[model samples]
Target: MGIFRFSDMPLKKKITLIAVVSSSVSLLMACLVFILSESLTFPRVMRQNLSNLAQIIGDNSTAALSFNDSRTAQGLLDTLKANPHILSACLYDLKGQVFARYARPDAPQYWPAVVWEEKSEFSGGSVRIFQPVLSGGDRVGTLYLESDTREMQLRMMDYTLVTVVVGVLAFLISLLVASRLQQRVTGPLQQVVDRMKDIAKGEGDLTKRLEVTGKDEIGEVAEAFNTFVGKLQGVEDMKLDLISVVSHQLKTPVAEINGFIENMMMGLTGELNPKQKTYLDEMRAIGRENYRLITDLLSASKIDRGVVTVDLKPVSTKEVVGLAIRDYEVPLARKGLSLELEGVWEGGMLYADRDKLVEALRNLINNAIKCTDKGSITVRALTEGDMGVIEVADTGIGMDAETMGRLFTKNRVLGKEAHRSGAGLGLYITKNFMKQQNGDITVTSEKGRGTCFKLAVPRFKPGEGGRL
Candidate 1:
């Protein structure tokens, strides 16, 4: 298994991460303060020990110098050496030279200083004490004493150990608290995620709301998600209702026209003359328009219900375009317009539904012929990138931005002129059918210039490749 990245982590992990990082920072700050306090206290305790030793050495030095006896001074120094705290002792003359020195024999060569301005070196824990000798206010020698600080060192060590133990206990307690906090934060988020997954799988019930407890950001998120789901459900219901009403309204007119056309064609009515036959032909044409409208309504209804299915196959784009042109040739000639086919290929194939592709192409052509006064409509196909592009360009009265925006919307009439001739479901049906086939349609137009509709489909085998 691969290691998870931070971005891929769930809400629970993110909450846990926040808790851990915050606790770690707090613990570090506490440790820093403890170390600083210990460092400050250690130096103060050592200085206090030095001051006490200095006082004791000064009293002994005063008695030795007053009696003017070297034996007494030496005896006092020997007694000081026997003490566990004392490390070394020295006596200096009036000229600051070491006249006499008595140190512990087992002590290190580098003994602690007493009167020098700089500190001295000693083994283990050490303190330095200085004493000046005076007799009748006359210049005399100085006494130096060195002492060990093992007791103070042991005290500091004990304090440090206690601090470490307390810190560890605090960290463990914080871990428990963090876990509980993470649970509280992630619980609602998990519910929201599960509900979203249900909605994506088509279970769009808006009443499935999360139980909001606290007024925190997580609760707010849950409330917002509930609102969003509710709005989505309402919109879906509205679309379904619209499709139902539009279908009923369109089907009635289409069924009536179909019945009328059937009756006339079967001669169920009276016989017709040449003029009457022409009128009947026009009525048949209107019936065909109504049939196209009904078909478009059905297609739009299916698309809205999300029930449209595509049958993908490796079909030749050239063959479909040729068939579309063949279907519209007679209509184009009758409407005083010309149809031009360009870039015909023997094996320009695409992966799409051949029947749907032909239907989409015919819609675009019919739309062009309806809008154009007297101009040529061109259908061209070529390969660009990894897709086959079919373009239908017409030198017709092109649409403005307002019309173009509603061109692919269901039942949206572009203008009164186009509506008087036919309904405006051609482009809408074309767009939906293209989408069902894993393709897309795009358009470009200007008011006085022209309009071009381009269909893009994934290309099939170009040279010597296998079937899709």
Candidate 2:
């Protein structure tokens, strides 16, 4: 019932169906055009030949008719019938009476009555001639003739048979050509489908590629598909490598925390004074920080695995930015940095997952606070173009061009003095989160000047803002 219903059928059957349908329609049209052209032109040709023959007989009989010599007139009529194509000859008086008639019995009987009047039916056809034929102002008896057109009918039949035969041959040839064309096209497509099936079933063989034999559109599609599969396989390999490295990094910190705690429990480090207990507490805090780092790493990995789904809704961008700044207030103060919020009173709603947006803003704020010392961190929100823009600018020790270039790259930590304490996952996670929300983040930094990170969230329309 649908156009694509036959898509899943076997390739051979599809090819056959296309070939048969196309050939049948082509043959039908060809036959119609051939028959119509012949029907129109054949009659006009027969009529022209009959007119020419009548002119000749009329010229020859003019003298005999004027003199009233029946023998002379009859001789002209006999001569006219000698030609096989001239089926009938007739002479009429001025009173519209048939004075003489010559015809073949085997031909159609309508010829004799057809030639006596200005408009008359002739041997299965029609003819017309003027009575009292005039030549150089002379009067002659009315001359008329009829043609059977049986030979013309026979010729037309022969032509029709030839056209039909040619149409059938052409249809057969087209069917064969179409079948070959379909094979060439669908063969490569089927190969790609089979390879895709194998890949879906966890086959990792990257050697399989669709063969490219031509420069057509289909061949280009095959090449593009092959390139995509190659890149996907490469990503899979990199993912495996990342998991292995992250696991090892996590295990080392966990092992150190466990060993340090065990040593304290066993009193192997010596008896602890009050001051020493404080140092131990600091060590425990460090262990907790390590644990938190591991948790964040796991969260980032889950994001990469597409395990996190966002619930998008309209939320005030100002409120979200203010909340992120508030969460990092104490840390910013401790680092001798001021956290400032501007444009908070402006009402601009963004369509996004509120929780995800908050998380993304928090990461950026944390990074800004950590990297800036003795300078202010400003979070600004406003409408820009079709988007709600949130910018976190820090007057900290900014990074160089090289560091800024690799800032959002996975596992890349900008080795500036301000970034010594961070794991480099903050911006990566923030970038990914923005992408999930159909938003984007950009960074501009110059060494010792300042760093400004911009986040753009699409503005929400009234009644169009809801959970995605």
Candidate 3:
């Protein structure tokens, strides 16, 4: 048999078990104390009472015994008839003859024969008390008292039974009360645990507060949790405010700069020398990257606000690919990398937000331009079952496993150039756009070999322009 471990049980069982065990132990202690006291004191009390009874009988029977009056001596010994514990009584003359005697009607069946002795003994649940009768300091006769102790033993057994019954009752009552009170402690803690789970699972609504019931440890825990949530809410609000201001304010000047550069490059301002135009070309590229960063931040803010809207329409696959290629033509040319298009589905179409698809392709093209050093960047498109797959492969310093794992997360810009110029939010925003259009993006890369990005889009069906 194995002993049960208390800690493995639930809290409610622990409380109830503790209460029952404690009450039983306390009751058992009380019962043991009562038994011990009774055992030690009861025998002495019974012996003293027997001794006093013998003395009184001897004192009264002195005259009857000295004169040898059998009737008076019998009457004197008969006084013990009222006490049920006194089984038998005898008055003996100095010659050791039992001159007179009195025996209880309910006395033991076998009694010791009256021996001629001045000594008493205890045997067979009774005590034999032998006391000498004296008259004027002279021994006259002896009084013998035999007391039955069975009644006292039965009384102690009854007391023990009552003690056991009371102990059981106390244990039950204590268990019930402790179980009810234990809920007061575990109930609030359970509520707190539930609320924390809700916050963790759903949209983190830090504004939710707990009900403070009383000034106890549970209340203190609730107060502390509420305080922690308030602090987190403050931090989230501050982060959003800062991002909003920077996204809106910083984009204006950078857009203006791009606008002026375009005007100058198109000969709207003035003609430029080769060196001046080259420097202006570099500046234009930097400005364009900066503008793209700001736009990514603004898009992230919109996503956080749950305002992602996609205006879907039927678009030619060639048109989408053409726009992305033309948008990144300068970066590809600057890096001396050729663009190759393979398996372009000519007649196939897509039902998606045209701008989102083109923008996502543009980010992929820019990423390809950043990583490739030698081989051509290949663009492939084909209809595969119900979806259209657009793949962009780059022969560049590809990403390792760790970089690929966090590639689509915010603030995870990989390359040195990307870290300096990019806000690390492009792929994050692009991923969301793909998801919003019911499409997906995946990547396959190796550290030193190459990398490829695949964008899957829902193919356009008949009578499905924006909704299907």
Q: Count of backbone clashes for each model?
A: 0, 0, 0
TM-score of each: 0.49, 0.45, 0.63
The whole-model C-alpha lDDT of candidate 2 against the native structure comes to: 0.73
Candidate 1 lDDT by residue in tens digits, 234-352: 78768876866887888888788778877887788878677877887888888788777767767777776767888878888778887888767677888788877788664387988
Tell me the tens digit of each residue's lDDT in model 3 across 93-115. Answer: 88878788888987754434556
Better of 1 and 3 by TM-score: 3
Best by lDDT: 3
Report the alpha-carbon TM-score of model 3 versus the true structure.
0.63
**Candidate 2 TM-score to native:** 0.45
lDDT of 3: 0.82
lDDT (Cα, 0-100) at 199 in candidate 3: 81
Clashing pairs in 3: none
Q: What is the C-alpha RMSD of each candidate to the true structure, in Å?
A: 11.7, 15.1, 7.9
In candidate 1, list every pair of residues with a backbone clash.
Answer: none
Candidate 3 Cα deviation (angstroms), residue 130: 5.7
